[model samples]
Target chain A: MNVRIDTYQQAVSRILRFDRVQRTAHWANALLFGILMLTALLLYFPGLSGIVGRRALVVNIHVWTGIALPVPLLISLLGPWGARMRRDLRRVNKWTRDEIAWLWALGRRAPRVVDKFNPGQKLNSLFVGGSIVVMLATGIVLKWFQFFPVSWRMGATFVHDVLAFAIFVVVIGHIIFALAHPESMRSMVKGWVTEGWAARHAPAWLREETGEMEEDQSVAHSD
Target chain B: MTTTAKGAPDQKAGVTIAVGRRVFLGMTALGLAGIVFGARLESVLDSGLQRLFPWWPGFRIYSISGSYPMISEAEYRLEISGLVDRPRVFTLADLKAMPSTSFSQEFQCVTGWTVPNVEWEGVKLSDILDEAGVRQGATALSFESYDGADSESLTLYQAQLPDVIVAYRMLGAPVTTEHGGPVRLYVGPMFGYKSLKWLSAIRVVDQVIPGYWEQNGYPLNGWRDGSTGPTDLALTGGVA
Candidate 1:
């Protein structure tokens, strides 16, 4: 009754792959966004504007990175590559009978490991994506308004502050996970994974893409 | 303008070298374009969009029903009345003579943009009120701006959120005419509506009164963090 896109394994492998340009933009944006967030936090502390000295420079950097953040993000939205990445990122849940049994046995932790994205990552994507849009809008409004009334600006401040805080927390989690799972980080850095690493962490994806079952994998290993 | 500069090499030098020259020129042009665009954008960001679009209704403030300029310092007057033992009428000079308090905080607008950490300098409303002395039963104060767009009045509690102050200076400079110079109120923490410009009057009252925007169906309290809708009729109850 239901159609499945290439098995979960294929989707995972696709996501783990990135081109050199994609990786460069991804890391550049990550660094820039991190700096922008830090400057934003500095905005809260008095006298920081003096050291950064020019409010205009702070805003310039913030706006530039804001503009840049969307570039890599949008580029990742095309063709087969984008499609697979989207599938992996999607919150669509497809739990098989065995998976259901595993969930029943392991409680919350089982689904966390098997789920396409843990609830937190899904929430993080939504919040971060939403925050970027809001920040862009408010930043432009503040920057180019012929007559930005006071009330709207005030409201924007609260939203920006709150979202920035939320992003900070979520990004911390993302960093921790990337570091904790060195192999996961390695794939992103290297743009390719060996058969062994692929089989261990993404066996289902490996099997789906190669059309090899677990039994076939042992036969291949012996050969 | 010619593609080559005055001291630059002649195009006749060689085709291969000319191609390299053309590439260099192209890159320089792009770099120059980026710098120009970046600089323009920087200025645009520093001044805020309100400065760019004056005709937009949301960008301007209308007082007490939009009949006339909602705020005009020229027609403004500050009266210390109510339970005050000595009700005094202070001119702009009188208010300016008072000790001033200034600090920087984010200026938030409800429409969704913020001018971070604007330096605001003004005399504390409380300090002025204390000098005049609040008589018994003086539960609140009221503000009236030159803008008559508001159909109702704002109560003291609404006016005197801790972040509130009668501001006169911004960014360490006495406000210019364009920037609500002479004297204006800066309501901290709240959106720009709370900071009335061309502020000319302050009066002590015994009861909470809805402000101009409040009567116009804006939130009475107008707290920035409340529900994300324009529920202006809700009263913020507290004594300031």
Candidate 2:
């Protein structure tokens, strides 16, 4: 009976792992980010632009994509996922002692309690979100550079390039981590992780999801 | 003891003289420092930013004609017609005979590149217009290239700006064929497009007419000073 109950609870947890809203926003944001990265790469590298041909077309597409990037994000805010996104945003802003300890330990030791997002993931999200805002602002100024003073335009370009470099480094780091942990990728793609995988990696999070302290305690002891 | 002009003692006058000399020296030092700082600041603002980017020779050449048109100096004639009471034609020598003025200006292209402190010497467009006797109703001037491949227009006001001239020389030398020799329109505060190259003819008109690039979707009023004028170009299709 105990084993059967455990199996039933695990199935429930798997189903509730990632809802449609979160999955949609994640994929949409990723798609936009990929487009932005490719266009930026082409624009920054003159050789690449030469190879691509049709520089005007590439530039137009890049400008349009950059302008349209925030659409999905803004749309997501009006849907059922809005509250969840807000909660995640609030959660990411604060770093708990356990999170700091987990970071210091370099994942060698687990935190006493973990939420839906790990500290690193939270930081990554915050950075990417902040970067998008900055990129959008600078991009608008650059596109309408004629409207602004030369010094202001130059300053905007400087800031935009610096931020792009910083974001590029952070994105590479994010990709490396994602590749290192295939389970994380699977969770983003398939919207579910196995009970065992969750217990091993995010045991505290799994406990919170299950809402059974005694059962989680037993599982912890067994491990 | 020697007496001063004010009948003061030589000792007191000597002290006053010393103080005056010191004050004069301080002011001279400050003035020299200020001039140096001002020059440095101007240089940085002028060409330092341009140096940060790849520098191209001969004004970052862009021509719709595919190739730069070569006009022999002997055959070149600038025709001034349309809303002029006295329509006239001037040869290269005739333009050269006119009084010439030179000024240092930054050239800004509509495509977002700039060349700074280009010394252009030419007869002012206003002087030419005045010689042709511009009619009262003339509102704008249409400039055509020698090859007739491209043309640009400027409002009468824009053409009359102090820096607006029909340039035949750049950097103290005659303008090269590659850089619109013989004569090219130079509207200093406007984009390079408005400063039409390979000039051939000018026609004063009653209304603003779009030029080559302007017709192909560039701002009609390409002001480099970032002023949102009444006739500011309305960008369409992300061209500019």
Candidate 3:
């Protein structure tokens, strides 16, 4: 029984921070978002419009990209990776007192023991996910505005623009945070961080997976 | 353990049904509220928005030639020739003397802006076609603008569409030169590009002739029904 438990702990410890499926979905969504932003800039800015060669062409690409934004997410949800994502999402949604204290003491000290994703990361993901749905619905209405009354179209356009600006700000903040933490960036790119980095930054998560904590509490406490 | 497993599906099915019913009820309530609110607010709020933020207009001048030809009412004449039993030229006074029809229509642009409820007063193109005696085998009517650079054509059937007219007055007044004056053709159901301004001549033809914008990738039909056409694909270099 002891040998079997030791082997199971080793297997979990060897697992990468992000699996192949998750990384692929993340990159696909990133590419789609880039396409959406570029097309939107081309449409909204008249001075840059000449570079696109034709207005109708860019409009079609923009509409089609907006429609395809959710495809990667939906595809990811069909596999075991989806179940893992749901578990992570549940963890993020329910904040413990320790998390609140961590937020209050941020920059002054290291945060409390966090799981795979901290509260900030969870909030960012949720905002982006919700923004995608809002953008898709508003885009469809605008594209097929003839089917709807003028009032509805007006309302939809207003909402879509406001949400797009908000999402842009959130995305910038997310990128800055990723860049600030080289270990987190490496986990997303290489699908793993050094065991030392995981133990130091995500002690609870490492303990949950490996069923053991590092002996040096000072290392975990330091930012 | 076996009995508990068997009961699980039944409980899951019951939960699914309950959730589905709640979703249905919630959606129905939301939809009803939306319809009621939309109808009540559309007239007042839509107009208010238009007033505050008017980007495009009902009568935006877009002449192919930099300058629009200005013709006096006295000098203006609409010449009808080609594939007609009787070729004729009618002065503005003669066109006004014919039985007139008026209606409000939304002028839609191919670029996706619309000017709503524009009241146009004019005689039907069919009435003028009738007067000129369009000969058998004539499939289309080509329109020339006094502006010299722009022209449009419609099939004989298109010309006969009930609302298509040679509009002389706009909003209960004489159409100014700035807005396709002494006379202009209004292809009511088609995009604004098809409605050639500065009306000069109409010629009956044996085949469909592509208009100015139509030659440059705007749709030939351009009907407001949102039907996909060659131009819609052509704009994307036929990729879509």
Q: Give Cα-based local distance difference scores for all models.
A: 0.53, 0.68, 0.69
Give a tens-digit lDDT track for model 1, residues A101-134.
4434754444313222333443445555555666
Off by over 4 Å in 2: A1-16, A42-60, A81-83, A98-114, A144-150, A212-223, B1-152, B155-188, B191-207, B211-219, B232-240
Question: Per-residue error at B204 for model 1, in Å?
Answer: 33
Question: Across all candidates, what is each one's fraction of true contacts kept?
Answer: 0.07, 0.01, 0.01
Q: Is the docking of candidate 2 incorrect, acceptable, medium or high quality?
A: incorrect
lDDT of 2 at A176: 94
What's the distance in Å from true for residue A71, model 1?
Answer: 1.4
Report the C-alpha lDDT of model 3 over B23-100, residue by residue, as the tens digit: 334543443344335334444455776776553222435655645578999999999999999999999999999999
DockQ of 3: 0.07
Residue pairs that clash (backbone atoms under 3 angstroms), model 2: none
Model 3 lDDT per residue over A1-223, tens place: 9999988866655546876677778889988888888877666543354344344567678889899998987878676667555444445554444555555676355444555666567556666666676677767766765565545554555556546667778878888988999878877787877667778777656655554234235434651
User: TM-score of each candidate?
Assistant: 0.42, 0.56, 0.51
Extract clashing residue pairs from model 3.
none
Top lDDT prediction, candidate number = 3
lDDT tens digits, residues B1-240, model 2? Answer: 111221222122122222223333444343333322433443455454456545321254544554466888899989999999999999999999999989998776554445667899999999999999999888888889975678898888778778899999987788877568878889887777788888999999988778876765566787776553335643321122
**Best candidate (score: DockQ):** 3
lDDT of 1 by residue, B1-240 (tens): 011121122212211122223333454343333322433443355446447643211222222221233334454466667668778887666767898787888665554435556798878877777778877887766676554332234455554455577777788887644345566777675656667655656667777666664543455555556442454443444521
Q: Could you give me the TM-score of model 1 versus the true structure? A: 0.42
